[model samples]
Target: MAGFLVSCQSDARNATRIPPTPSEKLKSNWQKDAIDALTNNIRRKIDLDNSYFKRARIYFENEQYDLAINDINDAIENKDNVGDYYLLRGQVNRELNNLDAALQDAQRAEALQQVSPELYILMADILQEKKRFREAQNYLNRSLQMAPYDGSAYYVKGMLQSRIGDTTASLGSFKQAIDLNPRLLRAYQQNIIINNRLGNLNNALYYNNLALKRYPKDAILHFERGQFYNALNKSDSALLSYNKAAALDPKLTEAYFQSGSIYLKWKMHDAALKAFEKVKNNQAEYPQINYLIGVTLERMGYDDRASEFYKMELEKSPENQLAYAGVVRLQRREMGQYSTPSAREPAQPSAPTRILDTNRVQIRTIQPRRSIDMGTDTTRKVIIR
Candidate 1:
């Protein structure tokens, strides 16, 4: 895994992700079941052209790519108005990790004279994925011409701009995406990251707040809010946000870790231990939690126990150099040479961990995880600070 901590985002041009609304949600489950039943029935009986294509749409929506590909392939075999079939198949192919196939299907769709703004967007995604930056931008331009108000198109444009390191243009494109579609969650996330990278703290916070208002129950959003506040050196606000994130999603290790990190920095060992404890039992995916816990114990005068945790941390992360150092220091202290290592060879070194860093735990931006949204082609990281 890349470092959980990252510097974070810039500007964007990419496709837009369609946000689900209340009415959409209502039909979602019913439609999924209805479509599954209908498609299966259609396949068993007539398997008509329209039936195959309509079934393909349901499969696509529900992410049944394999079934969707089969249905669309059947739909395309008949030859009339097969453009949409080709486009849908191209998208399904992309989902199946068949990039070349996706490109070919898209080309076929365009060749069938079924071109639309959506087709241009799909072509752009394939080109961008293939690393054809210039051609990708051209397709994006074509898409905008056909459907300038398309939110997803604006997002895709932003993604391309950001990929090429055009921070200013990327940021502008992201802002446009949000303006066009207020519920574009990823766009809001990008704004927070980019504004922070550019030292536009106020703008970053503004985006954070906007996201929270729309998604108050999303723990990740609240966790991000904490990181933003911490980065701005607003310790109290950071703590509150972190606490809220933990409350909303008790299993969110990052939120607890952040809260503990703050308490540790403030010299509240008890509080820090409580936070690190949460991380310790939470599957141990994180890199530094064990190390931090050891340090917190040591600070609270539990030298022997602290040494054990430190050694455990080293066992988990052999690269944690500080764990080695902490072990050495604690050993020397036990031998009545607290100030320095013994001149003679000492006993074999053990490990220790509890962040094992300076007095302060650093706030950091985590690299954004893969967006996975159909709109997000590339990736970025989030700050953990």
Candidate 2:
């Protein structure tokens, strides 16, 4: 079995990751100083508008969209005349998936004479997300006309093209975005995703390398690299990348799940169980996690423990065929039927689970668990984030 913490070989095929430079670390210092200064100014009741906006930008950059929205709201409350405030708030709302509110905010910014290439691009993004492709294309064209060299405009154009099922055009636009601004992270990400989906693993790896050079500390990039490596059947490299991703961000439960999957493929049941347990502890309801743990335990001959997890998985995902199979096998075993069932046995079809019904008892809160949507195509799409 491969060691879980094993370092990747410095081989040409592996494309060794570069360490982040000292200069890259220094970039956060200015951001920290700016946030501190803004906080102090806000506390002193001085220039609340600018201070709140500045702090809000920091929050948005840090991916703290809720905190950013609160600050932007305060900024707008202090001075409603600022178009930039609405624009920033619209961006925050866009990230939060509040498409209608984001559109309203963008329109408000336009009414306030804040019409810029960025505003147009933002509108296009919101429209594309809403599946208003025609309107999104119009806005995107306007943004490009305003600032043809704008990397963000091209990024939005690429996203719009992708939504419209124009993967080739989207790839071209993404390349243009990268040419305009090599530091545009989203462009590289889109390129990598599209290339991988097109079965161009070499191109995907090349883009992944470029992105890692610029964003060596980004955990998502590492996780994506691991996926690419896994797709290429470079299991050792995939494992190394997954381990690096987990080390970079322990809360990234998907990395652990992927690592466990690789271990299970190798029949390293103990290692797989350890990795799956980490995912379960971090995110108990992670998709297929309980079912996978049950499989690992069953492989190790712990039928009782595996049966418990299989039932737990069934409770969470009624249509999980593998979990259902485990339940049947273990239940049969309990009845003294030691003969193993065929692995190729088809699972019985299950009734569709009702998510919500107005005629039923009015439950105010419902925590939905992720489940397989059997109706949808199981094949991966190029339109991933």
Candidate 3:
């Protein structure tokens, strides 16, 4: 809660895009159909424009924003008269963080007479990202008025409310989103975060459980459940949850980091080493991962390797006290001041959390550079550092 805020903006621009051949093999059935349609149309030289549009939508759904942009561009080039094509391109550009391009496309779409609630929502979300909050609010209000039961519009409203320091209203908006569309996973995630911000860990945990019931295979939710359990001092439960998350998505390096930290705490050095190694292998740049590895190595009496890791961490973060302490402890050990590193450990690192993006399921941890403004009153605007 201190570091991770669920922003109501897409991070799809930075997400990996699957290539066409791999996508055909690895993507969902709907994505496969779109690809097949595009492929067949290309081979037959028929209806290629609509085929590109359909494939672009599939790419968007897969979070392959770059490919989505390419396909949508091709579609627009083929048929610039269609309003929906401009709207789709605008959406793809928004996902790509091409805000200026997105705004231009939105304007084009509007001029083409595409005046739907979805288009309004897209324009509002784009404006929100641009920090034009008042304009965003106006567009969002219009979308809500046009489509009262649209869960996505409500979700965007929740994000706007949260941004402007109206947590109570934000929570209500998120709840309305959930009530309207139970499958809106991001709304559930936001509710869990707001509950945590309010110092209601139990409620946060309850929401996590609720989300898991709906999205049991969601690795990020499992990772969050682990964090909640660890906060509640349920270490055993935390480990189980973390392991489950890691199993679900081996790319989820934070799960390995958290599980390893717990293993280190339990003095299970070998297990700790393996978990940390998995994290190091998958994501060497993970926050303080080198420091954690150094501590685990020092605990296991591999002083030389431990010293190397400590130096590596210091290279990345010269101001890190824990890594600096690790180096000093090893130096002292070399001087025979201690037979082994002392029993007292450096202060454990704060638990790592994630920067949750809206409209996509990708999760990544941000360094604990600053704390959140967890004021008890919901009136305070939530600030992400």
Candidate maximizing TM-score: 2
Query: Superposing every Cα of model 2 onto the true structure, what RMSD results?
Result: 24.9
Q: Write the residue-wise lDDT of candidate 2 on 1-385 in tens digits.
A: 0221121122212321212223544757756756666677678876667668767888987778999999999988988877788999999998888999999999999999987888999999898878888998999999989999999898888998888699999999999999998888889999998999899999999999999998898899999999988988999999999989999999999999999999999988888999999999999878988999999988887888999999999999999899999999889888978744333344556669968767877758777988876796668676867
**Residue lDDT tens for model 1, 1-385:** 0110010011101111112223545767656555555455455654355556666777887667888899788877754456777888888887787989999989988998866998898788788878898998999999999999987688788889888889899899889998898776777888888888888988888988888887788788888888878987999999999999999999998899889999999988898999899987885768877778888888777788889988998888888899988898899888988543232335546667566666578878998888665775356766598
TM of each candidate vs. truth: 0.60, 0.70, 0.69
Q: Which ten residues in a row have the lowest lDDT in candidate 2?
A: 1-10
lDDT of each: 0.77, 0.84, 0.83
Task: Give the per-residue lDDT of model 3 (tens digit) for 182-244.
Answer: 877878999999998888999899888988988899899999999999989999999999999
* Order by TM-score, highest first: 2, 3, 1
Cα lDDT for residue 188, model 3?
94
Clashing pairs in 2: none
In model 3, the Cα lDDT at residue 297 comes to 83
**Which ranges of candidate 1 are over 4 A from the true structure?**
1-114, 163-166, 217-219, 243-253, 266-271, 277-285, 300-302, 314-321, 332-385
Candidate scoring better on TM-score of 2 and 3: 2
Ranked by TM-score, the better of candidates 1 and 2 is 2
